[model samples]
Target: MTALYPLFADLDGRPVLIVGGGAVAERKTRALLHCGAAVRVGAPRLTRTLRAWAAEGRLAHLAEPYHEGWLESAWLVIAATDDRALNARVKAAADARRILANVVDDPALSSFQVPAIVDRAPLTIAISSGGAAPVLARRLRERLEALFDPALGALARLAGDHRAAIRTACPDHGARRRFYDWLHDGPVLAQLRAGEPAAAERTLRARLDGAGEESPPAHRLDWIDPCPADPGQLTLHQLRLLNEADVLVHDAGVGEAVLSLARRDADRHLLDAGERKDPGTLRDKILARCAGRGNTVALISQPA
Candidate 1:
C-alpha cells in the first residue's frame, strides 16, 4: 500500500461547497460549519436540519441543480448525493478548476479522503487507510476514543497557553524534549485530572523557573534493527523511539505497520525505490536536518 500524507486543513472562513441535501450532506455541512467554513449547499431540496440552517442564514442555499458555478471561490467540494453520474460530474468540474473534491464512497474520484476523526477539541486524532478500509479506520478511531481522556483537551489548552514560556525556558532541543516529557509523564496532567488546575499551573511555573534538568546529546542518532513488521511485536524501547524521534529516516523495507507507530507530528523521510540505492545522499540530508535549530533523532533500519 502506498502512503497517504495526512493533513489537517484550517477552513476557518474559507468558502466550501456541498453538492447534496440528504443526511450524508447534512453531516458534512455540520462538520464544515464547525470549522468555520463559509458553506454553500447546491441542491434542489434539503433535509430538515439543512433547510433550517439555510433559513437561519448559517449557510447559503443554491436551491437549484448542481452546476460548475457552485465551484466558484470554493477551497474544496464534497459530493454526497447518491446519484453516481451527478457525483462524477461534480468531481470532473472540481478537477477542471483545480479544487480538492471528495465523492462519497468513491475514492477513485476523490482528490481527498476524509478520515475517521476523534475530536478532543484542541487535540484531534484522525485515522485513515487511504480510503481502502474506512471501516477499519473508524474501528481504530473508536478504540482511540475510548483510550484517550477528554480531559486531554483541557490539558492541551493549558499547554498551549504556556507554549511560549516553555519555549523560552528550554531553548535547546534536548531540554525542550525533556521538558515536554516531564509535562506528559509528570504531575501537570495529574493535577488537572485531580481538579487542581491552579496547582497544575503552579507546577508548570515551578519547572520553568528552574528545575535544572541536564540536557543530553544534541545529536543522538538511533537505529532500530527491523523487527517483525507487526507493530504489536515492538519492544518497549522501540515504541519509545518511534514516538520520540523528531526526524525519522527509514529505508524502503520498513512497512506502514512499523511506520504508523511514529507520532503524526514527526518529520518522516521515506526513501523510494531509486533513493534506496543511494544511502549516502539520504545520510547527508539527515545530517543537514540534524544540524538545524534543534536536535534530530533519525531512524535507520541498519547501521549507516
Candidate 2:
C-alpha cells in the first residue's frame, strides 16, 4: 500500500560521502550541501562546480578514486560514479554496514530511491516512481509545482503553532474534526493562498471564538459528482461540498491535483476499507457524529 513517510531531519554536520566528480556527482553534491551535510567528494577528477565547492571549503574533495574502506565511518553514501560495477559494489557495502545508499539510475543496486522533490519552504514534497517512471514522476512534480500556492507553508505554520490550543479546546474527536473542516473550507485557505497569513490567522481565530463549547457539529454533503462538465476544472460547488465534508474517504486513481483541492483543514480519511477502517467502528462513528450535529453524512466515490 502507498503511504506518506515521516520526514527525515537534515544531516547538518554528519559525514556523507559522494563517490564521483562528474555531472551526476555534482548534482548529488549540491543537494547534500544544500541540506547542510558535511560532504566529502572522492574522485580522480572533479568538475568546475565541485572544484569551486572544494576551494570554498564547503566540501572536502579527495583527488583519488573511491576506495571501499571509505564507507567505514560515513553515515550515508552516494555512488554517482560512471562505473556500474563500482556502484553495485558500493551499494552492497553500504547495505552490509546498515548505511543508506542511493545509486543513480540503478534502482536494483540502490538501498534507497531518491524521489523527485518539491521544496516549498516548510512544506517539502517527495515523489517516487518506485524506479519505474522517473520522467513521468518529474513531469507530475512540475505540475504540482504550479498547484501549491506559496501561502500553503504559512498556513501550515499557523496551524502547527496553535495545535496545542486546538487540541485542548476541542477534546472530543468529533468537535476537533469539525473545526478543522471549517478552518480549511472557510476563508483561511483562500487568504493564505492569496499571500495573506496574518489575515488568515485572524479569520481563523475569530471563527474559533464564535464557536461554542458544543458548537453545531459539521454536516457532510452528499457524494459530489466527480464528473464536472470540465473534467480538469475545480468547480466552486465542489469546493463548498468538500469544505463541509468532515472526513474525506477517497480511493486510488484520484488525481493528485484534484485531491490537492481538498480543504487543508479537512480530516482526510483514506478509504482503505477492510484493512484500515473497521466497517462497524467507522459506521458507528459516522452515525454518532451525524446524530449529534443533525448533519447528513455523505460518502464520495471516484468514477471507475
Candidate 3:
C-alpha cells in the first residue's frame, strides 16, 4: 500500500462534481454542502432527497448520464455510480484533467480517500486507515468524539475573539503560550462549559491585564530530556508545560526541534558546561529567578 499524506482541503465555494445521484452520492453531496462547496451532481436518476435538493436549487442536476466534459469545471470529482465501467471512465477522465478524484468503494482507482470525521465546526478530527480497515478508523473516531467535549468549539471561538489583544498583551512567545494554556485548562473554560460565556470573557480580559491571581509560593521545576528526535515522544503534560513556560533554562546540548516547542518569546537562559558543573548553584539560580519574578521556570536537561 502506498503511504498517503493526510491533509485538510478548503472546499468553500469551489466546484465539486459527483457522478451519480444514488445514496452514496447523496451522502457525499451532503458532506460537501456542509463544507460550503458548490456541488454539481450528474446522473440519469437521483434519490428522492437528491431529487428534492435539485428541485430546490441547492445543487445543479445534470439529469443525464455522466460525461467527460463534466470534469472541466470541477476542482474535485467523485464517481459513486453503481456501474463499474462508468466509474472507471469517470476516473480516467479525471486523471486526464489532472484532477483529484475518488471512485466509491475502489481505493485502487481513487486519488484520495475520505476519512471518518468528527466535526466540531472550527475544529475537525479526521481518522484514516490509508484505504484499509475503515470500520476500525470510524470506531476510533467515535471514541474520540466521546472523549472530546463539544465546548471545545466555544473555547476556540473565545480564543479567536481575543487573539489580537492576547498577542499584544503577551508579546513573548512563551508568555503567549502560557496564556493559552491557562485559557484552555483554567477556570475560564469551566465557566464557558457552565454556559457562562460572559463570565468567561470577563475572566479572560482580567487575566490578560495581569490582574489575575498571584502565583503560589511553591514553584514547580520540571527536569525534562530535550534529546528526543521525534516530538511525538514527549508526553502530553510535557508538551503542555513546554508550551506554557514563562522561562526556559536549557542545557546547551538541546536540539532546536525540542526548543522550538517552547514559546518563541519566552525568557531563555543557556546553562553552559561550567554552570552545569555546579548542580547546587544551578538549582538555586533557577529557583531564585522564579521567586524574584513569580514566573514559572522550566529546567530542561537530559533524563537520568
| TM-score, one value per model | 0.74, 0.69, 0.76
Q: Check candidate 1 and list the clashing pairs.
A: none
Taking the tens digit of each residue's C-alpha lDDT, what string does model 1 give over 83-141? Answer: 99999999999999999998996987788988898998899998888888888998999
Collision count of model 2: 0
Q: What overall lDDT, based on C-alpha atoms, would model 3 receive against the true structure?
A: 0.82
Number of the top TM-score candidate: 3
Q: How does candidate 1 score on lDDT?
A: 0.82
**C-alpha lDDT score of every prediction, in listed order:** 0.82, 0.73, 0.82
Clashing pairs in 2: none
In lDDT terms, how accurate is model 2?
Answer: 0.73
Q: Count the backbone clashes (under 3 Å) in each candidate.
A: 0, 0, 1
Regarding TM-score, does 1 or 2 come out ahead?
A: 1
Tell how far residue 268 is off in model 1, in angstroms. Answer: 14
- Kindly report the root-mean-square deviation of model 1 from the true structure over all alpha carbons: 6.8
> Residue 93 deviation, candidate 1, in Å?
0.8
Clashing pairs in 3: 173-265
